[model samples]
Target: MHWGYTSIGASTYKGFDVSYTDLIGTFGINFNLFNNDVVRYYSGFRLGLIWRETTPFPAVGGALGFDIKLSKFYSKIQFYLGMRLWTDYREDQKNHFYGDSSGYKRGLITNNALLQENGAIVLSMSW
Candidate 1:
């Protein structure tokens, strides 16, 4: 499981403040490609959900990385470095108004897009 927070803002959108809090949980199967007393390499596929705001988007991805043993007495302790790539669908809503004689008009605009080429660096411990 992974959890993170992100904040984004633009000077052009003075009155608009955009931020995101994300929580992600994944389950997958991994296989070891190389294994030794000091190091190991593995690869895996993952299926998960990314929760942003009130909606949860389905995500699919793969990971590849290696781990280095930190101590012989504590074999469960390992340093890990990995990379992941995933894709998901996201929808967002925006409010817009146009100039008119009837004052400001409000319209709900929904933006939908397929988000791809999303990558994250994984630096963590293995137990």
Candidate 2:
């Protein structure tokens, strides 16, 4: 289980800037494919919730990575690197309009789903 936070800023098609933050919590299990005194390889699945702009959405993803022992005497300290991919689903309640040349005046509300992918590089000490 882990908790993570991310802040994103981007420009929209209308040339406006917007920013938002996401709070995420995940619970999953990992299976070790290979292990030794210096390094270990593993893969896992994740099911979690993502809270953005005070709204909660569901997220599901998986990870594949390895951990390298960083301390010779303390095996609990390690460096981790991984690749993760997930899908986030949410409802779009705001107005969305086409370009002025399209002659579309009314806005549309629809459901939106986003695919989020990221990599993690971390140094951790476990008790």
Lowest summed lDDT window (length 10), candidate 2: 90-99
RMSD (Å) per prediction: 11.0, 8.9
| Best of the candidates, TM-score | 2
How many backbone clashes are present in model 1? Answer: 0
The residue pairs found clashing in candidate 2 are none
**Candidate 2, residue 49: lDDT:** 51
- Model 2, runs deviating above 4 Å: 1-19, 27-35, 74-113
Off by over 4 Å in 1: 1-16, 34-74, 93-112
* Overall lDDT per candidate, in order of appearance: 0.42, 0.42
Point out the worst 10-residue segment of candidate 1 by lDDT: 1-10
Q: Over the stretch 1-127, how does candidate 1's per-residue lDDT look in tens digits?
A: 1221121212122343443334344444444444444544544454545434455555554444444545567565566665555443333222212123243223233122333335666665655
What local lDDT score does residue 107 receive in model 2, on the 0 to 100 scale? 22
Question: Candidate 1 local accuracy as lDDT?
Answer: 0.42
lDDT of 2 by residue, 13-121 (tens): 3332322334444444444444354554445555555443455455555555555656677454445444344433322212222223233222233223233445667
